[model samples]
Target: MKQKVIVQLVDTLDLGGTERMSVNLANTFQEQGWESHLVVSRQSGGLQNYLNPEVQVHFLEKKSFKDLKAFWRLSKLTRKIKPDYIHAHSTSIYWAVLLKMLVGSFKLIWHDHFGLSDQLEENKRSEMVILSKWIDRFIVVNHKLLDYWQKLLPYRKNSIVYLSNFPYLKLNESIQKLPQFTFLNLANYRPQKDQLTLIESCKILDNEGFDFRVLLVGQQVDSNWETQIKQKISEYSLQEKVRVNGPSEDVTSLLAEVHVGVLSSESEGLPVSLLEYGLAKLPVICTDVGNCAEVLKSGELGQLVKVKDPKLLAEAMKHSINNYEEEVGKAQQLNQYVLEEYGALKFFESYQKLVGAVK
Candidate 1:
């Protein structure tokens, strides 16, 4: 009888996987006949274009980490909406925690979309542990994250859940490849993504007379890391072989044009791009990290390589193109997995149940 309201909080609307997931969740909530509100603490970016117009968007333009004025505005908005759950994504957990402390209402759910699964201890932060007490529910994108946090916070272990990410795109039954055999790595420019290694692999392909182009596309998070990527590209003479660009609002068209999808990340947690690749039915070759092996079904669905190994990555890329038809079959199989396991409807339903059980 009553409409449900939810506010998805994010530090920014950057084109990263976590930010995309935040927008996707908000849109899904609105489409499912719920009052969805997306609150951006700092600023909004290209990802905002992907959001449904009906979903309410709020911006704080937060200036610093400890900007009390921004938090004060956020507190006002939270009181106005009185969201059933303030689903905070990534570092925005701090904002949600502060909101609960300030207003003392609404269910607080923290979606831990941490990318690094290999070295959990190194990634741990004191601030996160201090704020964990306020979290009503903890949702992890991968099992590794779930396990790590559960052990660290054993008291709330039962409340932590392992929920895979669901992409915004639907499965494409009829897939198309570009005439030029292009490769697309749809990840933000960061040290964790290891785009430099992908560039090195492209150099190897170019040296071996492979007529292919690689597109490095995502939001430029770290300018210094991006500088390293460009320097590596120039160092390896892959100027024409690789094209670097920022986030694209039209990823569906890009997916349709790319023959192969790749991820060279050293760490990830059910990468949204990998799910999109399956939806697009593009053969994948990614470094074996995080839940990638789970997504690929232990290399049955696509190719997997060790982290940061350019030679292995290069060999896998060569094998993929050389065995194009076979790889495409694997791509189709992966599509089935993604559609069945990572549908937005299923994600929304799960969250609905989880929200009710929150402490």
Candidate 2:
């Protein structure tokens, strides 16, 4: 039997959830005995180092949306690779669809990581409708998106699958713990991430005499957003309480230094950061957004607060601190759930089935 070939398509490896997922999938596919290749349609970024050594990576260095040269390069590369399947992540689906039209027959799967969920714009929906005929399959991170897409493409219901995001951590049992009530918010600086809300929560906590620190780890993708966050941190006198670090290659190492994990995003899909927190066995406090409640098992596994509510977020943080032992136990339970349900073997099996059914 011939080994299967899969090429993962992504815009960049920019140290975000979708970028990390693309890298994880490529690595997982290679581990599952497939000839895995990763194609970056644009420039590379910090997360590129996470790609498995066995996986081949190609970069098109796309200049802009109208970079036809990059598209031509991708088509040529696809022809050379002759992959059994081309799994496109998010906006990269456009490139893959165009490649199929220009080149030849190859299974194209679109992995939707859209953060807006049901609130996706009409223009995007119209575009999807036009591309629906060319896309062979669809993979969504949450059931809400699955339902949304199912309604959008009633005729293609059979092609859509809902798969949960899994952790991509390399576990270490001997990590040294930091000596503080450290909270981690692992999200890029964006309007949707709502870092300002988290900062406000921290201010409330500080006023109530809670001596804790927050580590914001992700790319400063938007300069204006970064400026606003820094300004808020300064205004709240949270310079000592909050540290805005750019993306790190050593996420596991960073997780070791924190006692609690947090996600105060205004919106999300099934965030991989939450999974990483579980894998690290860190007690979590996240806003009730996207599939977070589902992942946290409706607050059974972790603490869930309402979005943009500083008082509620502060109270949750206080609760987690006061009930540290109990929260640790819950964290352990979440870790076990992630390992059992989202383990590499199970993920690979589901992916194999999805790919096999594509034809």
**TM-score top scorer:** 2
Tens digit of lDDT per residue, candidate 2, span 150-243? 9888999999999888778786668887788899999998888999999999999999899888999999878899999999999989999999
Residues 194-229 of candidate 1 have per-residue lDDT tens digits of 998999889889989999999999988899999999
TM-score of 1: 0.96
Question: What would the TM-scores of all predictions be?
Answer: 0.96, 0.97
Question: Highest lDDT among the candidates is held by which one?
Answer: 1
Q: Over 4 Å off in model 2, which ranges? A: 121-124
